[model samples]
Target: TGLTPWLAWVRGQAPPRRDFNPCGAYRFVRHPVYLSFMGLVWFTPTMTLDQAVLTGVWTVYLFVGSWLKDRRLEHFIGEPYREYERRVPGYPLMLVGPLATKRT
Candidate 1:
């Protein structure tokens, strides 16, 4: 449901949406892509020393980048984003219940 709107927004054809997203995987966590990337980094069956180092660096970058992105969104969207922040966890570890629960 959201992919098209997101793609449109990314293309600069639309403004940042004022609506809150609490559906699908977004209901479980705010940053699913970052979580997926982290999972890929840590859950690999085999990793060389260099891969481990790279994973660590990427993990750090993800955390920092997500923080920066969140701040930017909050600044751009203001109260709506702040309310969403209160309702949704930014990290997967912070998830509290089933992924489909739409808690507004």
Candidate 2:
């Protein structure tokens, strides 16, 4: 976790990591960061026109960004992340994305 896939890609290999495992919030959703941030973005008490516009934009951005991140993480993190994707959704609350596998 020293450098992200973006920064470490220049080195022509996966990041130098001993291991990768999903735990805690990751066990629930593949994109916990985006999920939590999306929640914060939509919780505005006063939904002014400009605020609503900004919130809408951020919502779209987060969805797209989370999808892209999934692809990127699969590429860099390899099979484990792919397995996780198969078992989870990008947004579990909305039941979004593919597979949505039932874990044993």
Give me the candidate number with maximum TM-score.
2
Q: What's each prediction's TM-score?
A: 0.70, 0.74
Model 1, range 1-104, lDDT digits (tens) per residue?
56877888789787445565568887767788989999999999999999999999999898788778888887977877777777777885555432222256
Listing every candidate in turn, what is its Cα RMSD in Å to the true structure after a full C-alpha superposition?
6.8, 4.2
The TM-score of predicted model 2 comes to 0.74
Task: After superposing candidate 2 on the true structure, give the runs of residues whose Cα lies further than 4 Å from its correct spot.
Answer: 3-15, 96-104
User: In model 2, what are the clashing residue pairs, if there are any?
Assistant: none
lDDT (C-alpha) at residue 68 in model 1: 85
**lDDT (CA) for every model shown?**
0.76, 0.74
**lDDT per residue (tens digit) for residues 1-104 in model 2:** 55576677997776657566788998878778887887887996778999889999998888788768777887878988877776776676555344244244
For model 2, what is the error of residue 82's alpha carbon versus the real structure, in angstroms, after optimal superposition? 1.2
